[model samples]
Target: MANYLLIAASSDIGGATARRLRDGGHHVITTARDASVIDPDVVLDATDFDAVDRVVAEAGDLDGIAVFAGSMLLKPAHLISRAQYDETIAASLTTSFAVVRAAGKHLRNGGSVVLSSSAVALAGLSNHDAIAAAKAGVIGLALSAAASYASHGLRVNAVAPGLVQTRLTEGLTSSDMSRKVSEAMHPLGRLGEPEDIARAVEFLLDPANDWITGQVLGVDGGLGALRPRQRV
Candidate 1:
């Protein structure tokens, strides 16, 4: 079994990933900001670099680390408040940077690191300006970290997922009409499930995929590559 550390384990994707890894005979150490909702091995905000370092120090000899911390804010660029922008960036890009930096320093040689991105970052979508920018920053962080740590045999990569059906997206997909619209927006004609992204994350975390590094694998249900079908 391989040892792994997961930051922000309270999210739907993080929880699903933890279960998948554990079921695969891997040991996972989880961290969460809210200890009440999800009991984690470590209770610390990943946005704090010092806290990330402390958690990784305690997680010792980890083979992989995945940062699943992120926030979704659907607002036009002109309407996004300063507070909203700050919060979104802190939740997405800032936390990602902290996790990747700490992992580069703490993870054992030949270990892997996985960060989260979004399909909106790769392809523009309406009212997603704030989130798109932040997630794009995550892609940059992953690529830079991968280059910085490659000599040590460490690999860093990212997963860019489309509209996954999770608590994070419940507000956008709760109603029947809204759900239909979301599904139609994807070329697959269905919204992505948390498990789908979880599986992609697992692949990157697997030590056997050591050759893959500095790549942003899109697990976006073909949304990133194909446009939505045109109405007749």
Candidate 2:
């Protein structure tokens, strides 16, 4: 069985991805900021480069790495404080950067790397300025890393999800009215499930799909690409 490292395995996407990878007969090593009920194999903050590198080194060589560590901030651009803005970037964009950097140095040649982006990066939405900017940075980072690692046969890609029902978005989906609005915003008429994003990550990490790289796969429920019918 091939070995893989999943950073932020405590999150919804991370937890689901771990189960999927393990059930596929692969060895999965998980990391999170703390060892809570999720029971991560390793506990380290993804934003800390030294901590990330140390844990990755200890995981030994990995066939692939999936970085699913991030948080969501839902507020008007004017309402968000400067400190909160920095926190958003640290949690979402910087964390992804750290994972890719560590993976670049430690992953076995020809290994694949997958990171998370968001549907907001592709389509504009009110109160998503902070997150949209961060996810957009993730896309750029993944593409550049893909080029830098291409000579080593290493592949890098990203998955941009739309309104997934995870802890990160519970606030937005908790109420019936809000949930309905969210569902309506997507062409699929529903918010995404953690498994939806997990499956996309699984596909990108598969060695059989080695020919694919440097691509951002939108796993959103057509929220980023489609428009609802309007009376003409």
Candidate 3:
């Protein structure tokens, strides 16, 4: 069984992914800003490299690190101030870098680094500018890390999700029109669930995935390839 350093386990996708790994017999050390909500062995602020290093030291040995700690900010271009945009970027991209750096220190020689991206990385979406840009960078970071860490026997990969029902998407809600439109955009005709992305992550983090690295796998129901206009 693997020992996982799970970041942001309080988030919808993060918590679900943590449970998924645990259900499959992995031990998870989680962290969120609020350590009391859930039992994260230590408190961590992904944006702070020093804090991340401190927590990694506390987690002892880890087989993998899942960087699923992120936030969503939907706003028009003009409305997106520098601070707001910086916050989003820090959460999605900067935190990822911190996690990778920490993993390089705490994870096992053949450990896994799993990060979360969004379909926006490859597609167009309104009000998603900040989040999308950060996620696109995430894809790049994962690949670069994969290359840099190969000699150390570490694997780096990313999973881009589309329209998963989570607190981040509360604005999208359960509207039938939004659901139908979004689902129709995907060739699979459905929105994603937490488990969908979670399973993909688990597969990539599995020891068997040692051969797979520096790849960005889409869990977006084919939105990256299909005609999204049909849904409109």
Candidate 4:
């Protein structure tokens, strides 16, 4: 079975992804700042530079890497200060960069890296300035990052999820109006589940997917494609 390095293992998406990999019999070394949030064999936050290095050091020769580290704080453009934007970038975008850099030495040749993005990167949304910017950078970083690691037969790609059911979206769960709005936003008439994105992550991480690199797959319940259009 393949081994995986799962950053943000404590997050709902990260945890679900990790569980999927584990249940499929792949070994996984997972990490998050709070050990209490994850039952992983190891715990470290990607945002913590030195701790992240240590975690990678301990988990050697991984077959794949899944970066699910992220945060969400919606606010009007005018209300989003530079410092807040930087924080979101650091947590959602910068952390992935650092994890990739750390994993390079341990990621086996021909292995893949999956970075998380959001459908917001392409679809317009209110109060999504910071996250959209960061996720967009993730899409941009994919090809360049793939280029840097191609010598080692490494592939990099990003997944842009839309309205997935997760802790990050717990607030929306309680609001029927919000849920209805979300459902209507996707032509599928439903929100994305964690498994939807998790399955996509699995495909991108599969070694057989060598030909598919430096791409962004939108696992957004048709939000990016069918949104802005009424479906009959």
Q: Which candidate's TM-score is highest?
A: 1
Off by over 4 Å in 1: 228-232
Order of candidate numbers by lDDT, starting with the best: 1, 2, 3, 4
Cα lDDT tens digits, model 2, 86-128, are 9989888899889888888887577999999998999999889
Worst 10 residues of 4 by lDDT: 223-232
When 2 and 4 are scored with TM-score, the better candidate is 2
- How high is each candidate's TM-score? 0.97, 0.96, 0.93, 0.93
Cα error of candidate 2 at position 27, Å: 0.3
Candidate 4 lDDT tens digits, 1-232: 8888888878888877887888989988877777776677776667776777777777777788889988887887789988998889998788888777776666655689899988998888888888888888888888688888888888889999999888888887669998998788887789988888889998898777888888889998777766456765
Better of 2 and 3 by TM-score: 2
- RMSDs, each prediction? 1.1, 1.4, 1.9, 1.7
For candidate 3, write residues 115-203 as lDDT tens digits: 99888889887888888889999999999999988988899999999888887777675687877777776788878888898888888
In model 4, the runs with Cα more than 4 Å from the true position are: none
Q: Using TM-score as the measure, what is the rank order of every candidate, best first?
A: 1, 2, 4, 3
Candidate 4 TM-score, C-alpha based = 0.93
lDDT of 1 by residue, 49-72 (tens): 998988888888999999998998
Cα distance off (Å), candidate 4, residue 144: 1.1
Which ten residues in a row are the worst by lDDT in model 1?
A: 223-232
**Span of ten consecutive residues with least summed lDDT in model 3:** 223-232
All models: lDDT? 0.91, 0.89, 0.84, 0.83
Question: How far out, in Å, is residue 220 in model 2?
Answer: 0.6
lDDT score for candidate 1 against the true structure = 0.91
